[model samples]
Structures are given as C-alpha cells and as structure tokens.
Target: MSARFGRLRRVLAVLLTAVACQSPPAVRAAAPPGPAARASGVVTWAASADRMGEGTAGQGYRLVVHTSVGGSDLRVRFTNAFGDRPLTLDGVYAGLRARGAALRPGSNRPLTFGGARTVTVPAGAVAWSDPLPGRIPAGTDLVVSLHTPDAAGPATGHWMAMQTSYTGRGGHTAEESGANWTQTTGSWWYIDSVAVRPSRAARGAVVALGDSITDGWHSTTDLDRRWPDYLARRLHAAGAPVQGVADEGISGNQVLADGAGQAALHRLDRDVLSQPGVRTVFLFEGVNDIKAHTGVTAAELVDGYREIARRAHAAGVCVVAATVAPFKGWPEWDPAAEAVRQEVNRFLRGSPDFDAVTDFDRVLRSPYDPERILPFFDGGDHLHPDDKGMQAMADAVDLDSLDCAR
Candidate 1:
C-alpha cells in the first residue's frame, strides 16, 4: 500500500512539473466596445472599388474608410444613406496589403449586423461595425469587402464635398424619411443625412444646402474646390476637428417648388434638421426658381426664403442667406427672369429674416457691370458660374459665420 501511494504521488508530481515547465496555450478574448479610438497619424477617406468616386453598375463596391487614428478594441461603420434599393451583404472581410499582397497573415473576418454575421440596410439606411479584435494602429490600410446581393440600377454619387470618413448616423425614422418626397417617388435621389463622427471636446458639423452651385457644377473634378470643400479645408487647416462640413446640395434643387429635386421645404427637415452634428446651415438657393419656375414672383420667392430661414431658426440652426447672382445671359434667361433674380437679390442683401448674409452676387457680378457675369467666370450658360465664379461664390461666405477653426 505504501509503495503504491509513492508511485501515485510521483506520477502526479511529474504531470504538475510538465505543465509548469511547458508554455501555456495562447488565449483570445472577446473584443470590447468603446468610443472611436484615435489611430494616430492617419487620414481616413471613403471610397468604392472600380471608380475613384463613382460606384459601378451590376458589380458591387465597397467604400473604404482609411483610419489614420487607429486604436484597440475597434469597430467600423458602413453606409447606404444614398442607396435606392435594399443593400444586402454577401460577406464582409478586412484585409491589409503589402506591395499589393496580403500583409497581415489572417486579414479576413466575418462582419456582423445587429451582432450577427450578415445585414441588410433598406434604402437610405446605414449599418455599423461589430467590435473587431486586437488593434488597428496608425498607417494601417484596412479594407472592408462588401458584396451587393442583387443587380443594381444606374448609380449617382454626391459630388460636392470631399469627405474624410463616411459615418453611419443611424437610420431615418418615418418622420424624418417622409420629408424627402423626391426620394420616396424615386425619379432620382441621393443621400439624406449629414454624416459626422464623435470627436473630442464635442464634435459639430456645418450643413451646406443648395442647388447646382452648391453641387459645384463647373468646379474642376478631383480638385475638391467646392465652397464647402474650401470651408472644410480651411477648418481642418486651422485644426478645427471639432467642426465639420456636410454638403447637402442636390443639382436643380429650388427653394419654393419641386424641380430636379423636391422643393426646399420638402427636404429641409431631413437635410437640415435631421443631419448629424449640424451646428450651422448655409441656405444658398433661389436661382433655379427664378429661372425655371416663373409662376412664383420675386415677392413670393422672398417670402418663401423667409419661411426657410424661420424653419431653420426654429430648429436652432444659424442661417446664412446668399444673394442671387446675375444670370442675364443664360440660355433660359429672359427679361422677366432677370427681374425676379434682381428682386430676390434685393431681399438677400437686406433681409432681416436670416441670422446673417453672404453676398455671392457681389462676388460673381463684374465690377463694371453688376447684371452680367464677368466674361472669365461664365460657363457660357450665363446662369451657372465657372470654376473661378464658383470660388468667388465660396469666398462670399462669411467665414466668421462659419466659425470653423481653420
């Protein structure tokens, strides 16, 4: 009995010694949740495959948010605030490339929605990233592979602002969704919300809303010289990460009635009020109404603008009204149209309804002749400002009103 007991003790001792001497098995943990962590020295911008800015037809595309400020226990967000149909995801994976080859040995992971592996966002909705493991540090180029589950239609992209990260500000409720009737009707529609990220010391965003001018009609492509782009560039240059800009312009949009887009009132609640981090709203419109919708008189257009300002102010947004520019030689230009344009300009120059004003007309109209666009600034249409003309329009904005840091 004593011999047996000694042998049993020896075997137990051997097993314990081996366990202590040998290396332990590696352990992995569930990723934790927290605020967006900073991935230092990173510049994150949104983009899809195939086109630098435009997504392709039929084939699915992924918009990558490059993170310069990376940190641990991190997660990501995907968007479809501009999609027309339900965006179904096939599989989501993360990857890092070295000289166009996979850098991180295991760069793929299944993405989940509402904490599950797959998600479907209805038109105008966005989905967020589940907590991903480990850390995505500075200089890490992470790509999310998104597959569209169905055949898609002709796509249009929001072209004005050069955005950094494409953020998901959650879904638009029925009340919010109902405001954009043009989107619901579906002739052609774009984004509905102002995407902004949470920044240190309380982040805020400025919303720029208007028609083609705000859409940057004649501005050179990839130059990113849109007024809002200039504004954001100025802000960022000034180290004003606290404030961002959201360009909500839709080509052919008007203040009083529907045209290429729903009337300004039809979109105000969603584009202006429901926007995330929107601290200020720059309402630059009325040219289209003056040129195309002649049924509404100058007085009516002025009052309509006043109502827009009223609505914005009621919602606590600082409103800046822009004076209409000279459109005397546009193909659609007529003496009656010019009169309405002049009358509308008169209201903007001296309107007490807005919190402040920007004289875009003063900047683009030739010094020698106030009614005619400077020969250099005309896009030959007479109505739309050329590149220089657009820049002049941007310069007309009251930088102080923007209160942007840079």
Candidate 2:
C-alpha cells in the first residue's frame, strides 16, 4: 500500500506542475474577414408614436453589446430587424454602464466611429461601427446609449436569443427583453449583442452558424439559455482556452438561399467564416431547409450540407456537423420530408466534410417513432424543442471532438 500510494502521489505532483506551467492559448493579433458590403444590427422596439411628446430629442433608442472581457478596440452592429420603413438616421453610442456593483455615473463614455458621431441605418439594414477605442472588461455590462431623434417604434434585436437583461442608468432598475406581460415589447429593442476581440492577442471570432436551435431558442431568457451559451459556458470553464463562440444563428434562416433569410450557403462565409477567432465552425443547420423544401430530395440537402462543411474546412476552420432532430406531425413536417431527412441524416452520420459530428438529433429524437418526436422534448409547436430539450441537445455535443482543431 505504501509503494502504490507513493507512486500515485508522484503522478499527481507531476500533473499539478504541468498544469501550473501551462499558458493560455496563443491569441495572435490579426485582422480577420467580415462582411464586405457592410451590415450591422438595429434597435427594433415597438414605437408608440404616442410616446413622442414634446420631449423627442432623448426619445430615440441606443444600443450596446457587452464583451466577455474589457479593454481594446471593438466592432459593433446595430440592426432594425423589425421595421416597416427605413429606420431614419440617428446617433448611436457605446459606453460602460455600471452594474449594480458599481457606485457612480461618471464612468460612462461615448463611443465614436471614424471621428463621426452619427449614422443612418436603412430599413432592414445593419450599421457596423468601425473599430473603436472601446475597452470592454470581462463580465462587465455594456450600456449602449442610443440617442434617437424621435421614437423608434417596435424594434427587434438579433443575438438576443433566450432573452437578455438590461440595467438602467442608476443600475438598480433591471428589465429583460423576454418579459411575457409588458405594455410593449420595448425591452427587445435598443441593442444587439456585443463581441470583443483582443487587439493584442485575439485572432477573431468563431462564428457559430446555425438555426434557432443554435440561436438557443427556449433557453431561459436573461439567464443565457442558448446552447451557444452552454458552449461558451464550457469554454470559460476550461482551465485555459482558445477561441470564442460568436453566435450568428438568425432565427428562421434557411439554406439554398430563399425567403426565410440568407440561405446557409449564401451566408456561410458571411455568417460563419467571417467571424474572428473563427478557426472553427460548429454547424447545426438544415432542419428548416428540409422542412421548408419538402419536395427536395435528401440527396440534394446532403449535397448542400457537405458544401457547407467543405467551405468552412477550406477556410481552415474545423467543421462540426450536427444532426437534425425529428419532427413528425408539425406544421412543417411531411412524410416525404421525413423520408428525406432520414436519408440525409444517414449520410451525415459518417461524412468527412466535418471534422466531427455532434449528434444532437440522435440524443433527443424519440426511439418509438424515428419520425415522430418525443412529447416531453417537443415544444408545443412540435418543431422546436422546449428549454430542457434544447439543453439536452447542447449537452449531447462532445467537447473533445473540437480539441484537435483548437
């Protein structure tokens, strides 16, 4: 027993020393690819023209995105995803907003782009800020003060999946964008998420391109319930890590380039390959493509999925392919579609376009009916999963599979 114990202690000592000597992943300061034409996020809030009294100058909205850590030049996107007409020109500001933990208002600072203080965002368009001298510390709340010219009516924000939180100037007041019973869904407006890149060591973003599932629908709002959040949570938990997950999963987006949104292939480089720290792409798209294009055969969808994998892989990003979950008797589900899904799924099971496979479909779909989904896991719509189901899907991914690429 003494001999065995001594050997074990030596092994443990060596392991501890190795861990102590380890360093954070190398983060090179390099300019990465992004949207060529230029696009950004907008503040889409349900604007009540009634709210516009004599006090209109301060009535408009401002948006801010928070970074994982603070310090460095960062880029921003302002979008108006829920407007009927062109959202007029207005001013935007990015600055530090105090968390309840902070004590004073003197900490706020205005963000500027290219020496300009204002921008005009066309309807359904996004305006991105040129890299600014914004210093974002980790876990710090970012206050995006949007000085609207007037009331910007009912606005929706992207990257605010599963609900998000906001703190007023005083910091005591708190509100969530996903509140069920609000006078107006004013909360959803005002801002999109903020992403940060280290000007010194950061490479770029690892754009997590996918559908609603990847967008983290049904995950607890304000609590950060998206699977990407789960994935991000995992990354942070890692003793020392590399890269970050920049979620670009637009809800209702599709492949083959159609009405839902830019198709997967159409926006592959834009959404996935364009992000910073994007040495990898974890793709879980295509259920919508199959359902929305039922008449389309499995072979075609399989071909498209392979193309997505190939494109990302070509860009030096290790691709991770996720299986599409089952959908039996839903609004979008059709027998023919199910057949096609099955065929495509089979091909994805052992394909090489992907560096690895994250079987989100296999883990959640019911055993009794491969086509029909399990009742417990299905959201009432039968298409999307409930929060629990979403978590299960996220949990199904194998973190080890991504290590080689990292």
- The regions of model 1 sitting more than 4 angstroms off are 1-58, 62-85, 90-112, 123-145, 151-202, 240-242, 403-406
Residue 149 lDDT (model 2): 57
Q: Which model scores highest in TM-score?
A: 2
> lDDT at 130 for candidate 2?
69
Off by over 4 Å in 2: 1-59, 64-71, 79-91, 95-107, 120-141, 148-193, 198-204, 403-406
Residues 117-203, model 2: lDDT tens digits: 666555444556666554556544565555445434444344223333332321112222213211211133533335455533333
CA error at residue 41 for candidate 1, angstroms: 20
Return the TM-score for candidate 1, rounded to 2 decimals. Answer: 0.64
lDDT of 1 by residue, 285-378 (tens): 8887877745879988888888888887876777887888787777667888888888888878787787778888878888887788887888
TM-score of each: 0.64, 0.69
lDDT of each: 0.53, 0.53
lDDT of 1: 0.53
